[model samples]
Target: MLKIKNLHASIDDNGVLKSILKGINLEIKAGEVHAIMGPNGSGKSTLASVVAGKEEFEVTKGTVLFNDEDIEDLAAEERAHKGIFLSFQYPVEIPGVSVTNFMKTAINETRKAKGLEEMPAKEMLKLIREKSELLEIDRKFLSRSLNEGFSGGEKKRNEIFQMAMLEPKLAILDETDSGLDIDALRIVANGVNKLKSKDNAVLVITHYQRLLEYIVPDFVHVLLDGRIVKSGGKELAHELEEKGYDWIKEEVNA
Candidate 1:
């Protein structure tokens, strides 16, 4: 459902344009989970942000297409309206806004963008309850302020909860496994797996293979120095886990 072609991007660092993503070519069809594994500064998150239309980075070359349409010029909000959901590495907490209320507003706004009316209160409440239960979230947790003072696990789970409610066609999870305990990681991955469908896709960007154990990927890609250096199936994750990225780096240099 998403295609990126020779995508080149750079970020301004202290007034100097430093390249990050250099000629990244990837295609993710519907009903597939693609895992991007790389070391620090390999441009994994950069790919996610550029795809989601973050303006901080400049796309000097290449194109990003969603459902066969060019999205390079689309703003971040517009991309989101087109069913692109990005789970941030560090989710910001909005104080004074309860999670329930925040989700209500967000869903309504997305509906409005699609020329639809506000969801009925009853339907919204029902969806909230159902999705919360799907994520094994306590109802009382929904009443807490959005992400405010939440532990790392809670924040990540909340991100997935929002994903469930929004039901985006393409969900890009950037470093979602960071800071999560084994149990928290399982719960989050389980929620993601339950929500996956033949009509949607997931792109998981992570540093380690542990997350892949729960959210098994259809494809495993190793990104290095702003480019995807290798691509393989799920077994690649185990290989990387046992050998670490050093072998991959050696292969790249060789």
Candidate 2:
């Protein structure tokens, strides 16, 4: 559902253009889950941001095509309106706004963008209950402030909860596994798996294979130095786990 071709991007650091993603080429078909593994400063998150149409980063070359249309000129919210969901690495906390209210506003905004009337209150409540239960979230949790005082797992799960509610066609999870304990990780991954289907795609950017153990991607891609250096089946994740990225770096430099 998403295709990226020779994508080069850079960020302005105090007015100097610092290149990050260089010549990134990838394609994610519908119903497939893809994992991107890379070391620090390897442009993993950059790739995610560029795809989500973040404003800070500029695309110097190439194109990001969603379904069949190029999305280079689309703003972040417009891209979101088009069913591109990006889960942030660090989700912001809104202390005064309750989770339920926040989600209600967000859903309504997206609907308004689509020229649709607001969803009925009854339907919204039903959806909230179903999605929270699907992720094993307590109703009490929903009444609390959004991401406020939430544990790492709670924050990640809340993002997944939003994902469930929005039902985006392409969900880009940027390091969703960060700071999660094993049990928390399982819950998050389980929620993700439950949401997967024949029409949606997930792009998981992570540093470890443990996340893959739970999500079980169809393809494992090793990204190094702003480019995807290797691609393989799920077993490649295990190999990276056992051997670390050193071997891949060695091979790349050889």
Q: Which one wins on lDDT? A: 1
Q: Single out the weakest 10-residue window by summed lDDT for candidate 2.
A: 179-188
lDDT of 2 by residue, 56-129 (tens): 99999999999999999899999999999988899999999999999999899999999999999999999999
Taken over the whole model, the C-alpha lDDT of each candidate is 0.95, 0.94
List the candidate 1 regions with Cα displacement exceeding 4 Å. Answer: none
Clash counts for all predictions: 0, 0
TM-score of each: 0.98, 0.98
Model 1 reaches what TM-score against the true structure? 0.98
What 10-residue stretch in candidate 1 is worst by lDDT? 72-81
CA shift of 226, model 1, Å: 0.2
Candidate 1: tens digits of C-alpha lDDT, residues 1-254? 99999999999999999999999999999999999999998999999999999999999999999999999889998899899999999999999999999999999998998999999999999999999998899999999999999999999999999999999999999999998999889999999999999999999999899999999999999999999999999999999999999999999999
